[model samples]
Target chain A: MEIVKKVVIAGHFGVGKTSLVSRFVHQKFSDQYLTTIGVKIDKKVIELEGATVKMMLWDIAGESSAMKIPKKYLAGAHGLFYVFDLSREETYRNLDTDLFELNKSLNGNPAIVLGNKSDLVEETFIEKLHSSIATDFKITSAKSGENVEEAFLQLAKEML
Target chain B: MNLNEIKFRPLEKKTQVIVFDQKGKVLETDNTLVEVNPEGVNIFEDTILCGMEEQFLSLKKGEQVELDCIHTDFFGKESHYDFVVMRLEEENPSYGLVIYDFGAQYNQLFDLQQERNMAQIQSHRLERENKELVDEKTTIERLYNEMKDDSSSSQYILVKADSLLYNLDFKEILYLEAYGDYIKVHTENKVYVTHNTMKRVEEILPANRFFRVHRSFIVQLSKIENIEQMSLLIRGKDKVIPIGKSYKSILLQKMDQL
Candidate 1:
């Protein structure tokens, strides 16, 4: 039996969710930011611990609040990757509330919070952000392909 | 026209129809645009369809559910579709899936949305840049004010002469004297003449340190040694500056005396 899991990539507008998915799935990165309409699905197969896992990544349209996301798009999701641009403070300033609402829909599904665009920010800024937020997040860069694979694999491992 | 002679036109080529049982097993297909799997065609193969099973199950006979912007790559080509599922009014009560290929329209919308999003991001970036510039300007102005305050006692006035500029220290000046079209700046060591007026020189000097005692003379307060009834003598200088009758009272009020 093939283990297939649906994972959702969600965040505010222009948060690099699409870029992260493209970098991880296709090993391609683009500087152009074209907004996602509705949902775009991409599949990737990865080997972990002697098991093959097929992950269906659903890139949902961006909304300012998690509650504004279409419930259907998040339905039957086994994992979630909540991404935010590190250089934009407004993207994650209300993270506490956004995470609370997103978790309510997940029903205890595994989620990884990612602060993307690490190349645009300084190391001190990343340190300060870690101290200010209550949740733990991994710093990744879709442009530099830093930690992108690890984050997806980590979520896939947790989902399995 | 007779009922037997009447003919109906076929549906558009882009539209595909598939009939499925309640368990999502495809029983019949009238597909022209999409390629069907040789073994089977299951609605469960589409994740979106699986997600919408509840809505499909509750749909009554003759009632249909519509889902827009459904994406599929089943034809070996990426395409967008709008799907309509209707519960058939039959003995077996099967479901009919009508899929319309709307790739052209969806692509148009995608292009428009892409432009709007890019424009918004550009506007946001410009706003951030403008705010940073404003903050930098304010910081520079603050530092300039603080530096000006710190060096208040040792300020220099730039005096232009012939082809050179001179930074005359305020403490070294004895007094300013008007000479026709120019003002002579006398210091402890020398007298430097520049084309200026006493009135303009008074305004440039610090009000607390320099005072206008006469129409032609603006003396440094610290350079005054002795004040007589009609004139004042400069410290360490033999020259005496005449005090104007109209300016005597105010000049006396400005000086410290017992």
Candidate 2:
């Protein structure tokens, strides 16, 4: 049987959460920054072994505080992607607190942490940032489309 | 203790301590308290040790345990916490607790549950709509098939010509002629003229037995004596009917050998 899963893409403003979603869904990227207003929903179906998974992705507008995120938009989410911009120190700096706040708001769902815009940063710096954070994170560049598919697939696998 | 002060502390140092009675009532707490309440309500809600009062009372003297629970605030923000509980012998409270906040993890699971429900609703709606369309298409196809069977069985028909009616076997008719607003059906024994256009004449005739070879003629396939290059000769009629270029392929298609 085919199962439908709802996944949420969330992060701080300009952290490339929308960029990561666009790259994964449409396989295209733009350098221009188009801020998401409230939420944008897109659908994609992944073929699994003997079953198909239709994922309804909710790309919510970025915010520093989890409380500012509209709770309704996050409703019915199966999994979550917490993305941060690697080029910006502040984005990674607030990762722990933001994730804590998100955890409280979401009641602790399964989530994948992503460090986006990897193409703009040095690997050593990214590695250092990765080690400092307590969770396993995937470094990605939405513009370069690196590790975007793997991150989603990992979430999907965990969900299954 | 002021938990808000510890909220800003470094991640490594952010720790919470709570002392509760065997009944799971909050007696005292350290900097880990999420909400400040002088009312001192019970920490245990639906889970924890709320329903298992007997289990808490019958625990061994040095028993230690870990448990998780959800705490909802006035603003409706729910925080999840994991606690390690140890039976306290010297302290005023019977239980000493060390708490670890895991509210984010709980939030993620709740969101997943909500999303699954929404997806199931959408899938069900689409399935219902699809079933309705299939039912409608099947009903239309069944009616068409029944009508086709009825037409094929009707090999004879009554031809109304003016005030008189002529009973003619469709097989005996050679061809039809379009004359103004009337159609002259030519048979070997006699001619029957009716007040109807050739278009209407073609509609009533069974499609398998009649072939409209030209704009002014519809010939019975079995009554054809011979087929020439662009014309056909009727079995007993002296005149040959010309075939229209547009309908020439259709006539040839009907004459194709098995």
Candidate 3:
């Protein structure tokens, strides 16, 4: 039997990767912010082109604590969601380094980008930084849950 | 540990030496399409490779014999390293002494590598099988726990604060709202009011996961989906579970801990 598909969400700390998952799973919002330790795994059933894919989402630690990158978390993974807190320009600037590290770890694995907190933003920063990362990956928001489903849908298309 | 850390050696060339084995050994050179590798051959008297030992298996149980062997050679001009190869089994008449053909020798070497890879693959399969067996018990226990927590199948009997019942499946009872000398036991279909204190019900139900959200209310943790300050939105309707000031800290901790 084949294993379930796993998509990993990775980005700088407080980029709201966990919040994105909460928005989709719980359909509710928690304004209280808390740091994620190590990893947080969540599941969602997504109906792709023709299959009901059980997406096992692995939200990786985003803290800048000089912690070692976990390799086993990346293994058996089929897609990557690289997130950025668009409300903060510095977080957006750090996207290049994040993409570089992801490429090195994944060995050229496919990815999609997320610019969270779009409700707080004036414009889509993903477009401005489009040239630095693969155009297919960049997307905007979390507060409004805008473009969230599209991100994973694009991933399903590439992986499937 | 990272799989990338596991090093894979690239193929290179090498030279080999040959040796002979003598003793009262039963060596047979059979030609029954035996699968073997030349590089792994073992020489008799501990002088040849383990591969060559198979030839002895072909030999009689107690016959003494001379083994044939060739010096290990490299594949390319830039290749380095060497080996000593030998065989004890009688040469097959169908393919006699083609050992002199350098290309043939390399083909034998390739066969040897393939055999080694096959052996490694077999070992990996066994290790995975063993790990699966070892994890079976833990996996079952986890699944059983998940099932038990969600079943909430026990029949609950709500009683007065003046009395507590020993038999209760607190899971089936959705919630309890206290009124006067009677506390209501709200099961799936009907609500039965009993003269009991919310504290008494809280003592019997699972705490940490369960909560006493309101002054006169006790709610199952899993049943609450949303909390707006003091009010909790319980599952199944627009109803809310009120949170007492004293219970606020514990409820907040529960919300953040997960």
For each candidate, the alpha-carbon lDDT, in order, equals: 0.81, 0.71, 0.56
**TM-score-best of 1 and 2:** 1
Candidate 2, residue A59: how far the Cα is off, in Å: 26
User: Residues B19-113, candidate 1, lDDT per residue (tens digit)?
Assistant: 77777777666557666652565675543465345667777877887766666564565777777788875567678777778888888998988
After superposing candidate 2 on the true structure, give the runs of residues whose Cα lies further than 4 Å from its correct spot. A1-160, B1-27, B30-120, B155-158, B167-172, B179-181, B203-209, B221-228, B232-240, B252-257
What overall lDDT, based on C-alpha atoms, would model 2 receive against the true structure?
Answer: 0.71
Tens digit of per-residue lDDT, candidate 3, span B1-258: 111111122312221222233332312222122222344443332221221334434444224333222222212221112221223235421111111223445446546544654454356557767777889978998998777666545435444433544344666656778887677766666666666677777786666456777778887777777888778876776777778999888878877655
Per-residue lDDT of A1-160 in model 1, one digit per residue for the tens? 4576889898888989989999999999999887877777777889887787878888887777898887867767889999998988878978878888888879899999999999999999999999989999999999999999999999988998
- In candidate 1, the residue pairs with backbone N, CA or C atoms under 3 Å apart (3 or more residues apart, or in different chains) clash, namely none
- Model 3 RMSD in angstroms: 25.5
Instruction: Sort the predicted structures by TM-score, highest score first.
Output: 1, 2, 3
Query: Which ten-residue region of model 2 chain B has the weakest summed lDDT?
Result: B69-78
lDDT tens string, model 3, A1-160? 2224667788766678888888876666676555454456666777776677766677775633212446645555678887777655545565666676766655566787777877775555545655554534555566677877777778767877
Model 2, span B12-69: residue lDDT tens:
3334665567667766666444553425566443223332344455555568665543
Which portions of model 1 show Cα errors greater than 4 Å?
A: B1-13, B19-25, B40-67, B83-98, B154-258
Clash totals, every prediction:
0, 16, 32
Docking class of 3: incorrect
